[model samples]
Target: MLIGEVARRSGVSARMLRHYESLGLVVPSGRTVGGYREYAETDIQRIFHVESLRTLGLSLRQIGQVLDDPGFAPSALIGDLIRETERRLAREQELLKRLRAVDASGPTAWEGVLRITELLRGLGSPSAARRQQAVLAAEADVPAPVLAEAALAEADPHVAGALRWALARAGEDVVAALAPGLESPDADVRRRAVQVLADLPGDEAAEALTSALADLDPQVRAHAAIALGARGSAEAVPVLVAMIIDGVNDVDAAEVLGALASDPGRADAIKRALTAELADPAAPGPARLRLVQALAELPGPIALPMLRALVSDEDRTVARTAAALAGVIETQDGV
Candidate 1:
């Protein structure tokens, strides 16, 4: 088969296929005397394995070694894959738990909390709750946030309250381990702080969250906007609105802000964020899109003009979002 056929069969782009070749993961089985690359059925099948290994979370270098793994039998290879998958899943679980438990800097425990947390790490990722009763007993040895995270999935309000009370006396060392997860190294630590700050209650969290606004991650800035919506601060609206208008991830950021803007006080903040960009000449179509959506959610004569302007905008995508907004308004008004 030709290179194109290999790409078609493997669902890997031709450019990436060339990259794989450079990485030495695959080589054409033969070449024509005239110099055309020729591949065999075996080579195409090998490409699928490469794709599979990449999907399994192995880095290219790691994948290369996995392909070259020796002493390990087939069963051993499967076990390794399962272990890796579990590790990722555990990280996600930890992130979600932290999201639920974070309160703010106040009175929290440090020593006992660390002891309790080892129990969690011992849970081997997703089996996090397998040792529940023992964990709850040692819970006082953990951080309040970690304790709260551990109990987030439960429904009983009384149980939840009890957990919160326990969180009050959690140890400091445990607090250190209660960090959030992020894919980017720089974004990771800051995002973790942001998650904890936003979830934690009171003035300390507010101060921390304000500082987190300078985070380089657009996604984090957008999330900060949504978190502000819950707390209903006039100060955060402009930044969130600005992000909705011009941030690269405006679509997601706009959606979060819109959801949080239901409170009357937040309306003006979001409107302020949107109105400036509603008429911005240099901003991209998506900026206009999120702004229009935000304006539609607020619903006022101010937005109607922007919506009208959008109907005739140069960008088809912006015009489309505006048209949709107009339709939503018409539906609401019984037009």
Candidate 2:
């Protein structure tokens, strides 16, 4: 076949086939008597091979080596191609995300687009200070969803705080944006989501936190419980009680419970929960002692009876502490 027929059948342009010949990658098998290049079946096959390698992101030079060097082990080259492809894909995805974010900002002009782009660049900067400045300088311009995403991925404590603060001001849209982070497979991401949600005002944020209360991570659960309790949701009661028993942030848990007990019905429930723990013989000494201290946070009248009963308890430390607390309550109550 002539070069034209080969180019037509193989889908390789004639110019590219000539370029390949120039590089000595694929030379036509023969020449016509009139001097035009001619190609044999084997030469066309080599042309197809070069094109196949190009699809795998191989440079022309690498393809030359691959086609010429029979001893070349492709494993290392293939691995390198995979890594490079992954990096290129990551960059493309990031660029797409930035474009979407900029579009979401509803920029009306090129300047607005540039501003949003610069802000996004700062948010993604490696320096924590730059990330923080991006958030602090955002004002009402940067969209809430962007801030929420940055908040979830931010590793620096200070920058994370700034992101959360920005999200807090970004309004209810932030709640929806943060929803996916709550379901993230990464525990740290979920924890950060809960932390940001804790500061977000509104029932939606509270509802998101309610879902987080069931999170498998103890810290995630604890943060959710505290946030819920502060929101006056009784849903946090069980976790708060558990915190006391486990001695994990027991003091804060007790204080929130005490505040919750301002409601008469909730007060009764709180009293019963504490008494039940105290009655459990299997309860550890430290846990029981912590429980005793927690009870002291309750209203004087409500805590006094439990405190009085515990005064002569089996554990001397418990007895002395209870005795001291009860006496103080009695003196304060003028009983």
Would you estimate the TM-scores of all the predictions? 0.47, 0.94
Off by over 4 Å in 2: none
Which 10-residue span in candidate 2 carries the lowest summed lDDT?
A: 138-147
CA-lDDT, candidates in order: 0.61, 0.90
Per-residue lDDT tens digits of candidate 2, residues 1-335? 88788888999999999999999999988999999999988898899999999999999999999999999999999999999999999999999999999999999999989888989999889999999998889858678778888888999999999988888788658899999999999999999999999998888999999999899988899999999998888889888898999988899999999898888868877888889999899999999899889887888989999999998899999999899888888898899
Per-residue lDDT of candidate 1, residues 177-253 (tens digit): 33432223666445544554455566555655665566678766656656665676655666677676665556655
Find the 10 residues in a row with the least total lDDT in model 1. Answer: 174-183
Number of clashes in model 2? 0
Task: Write down the lDDT that model 1 would get.
Answer: 0.61
The prediction achieving the highest TM-score against the true structure is 2
* Candidate 1: residue 282 Cα off by (Å): 1.3
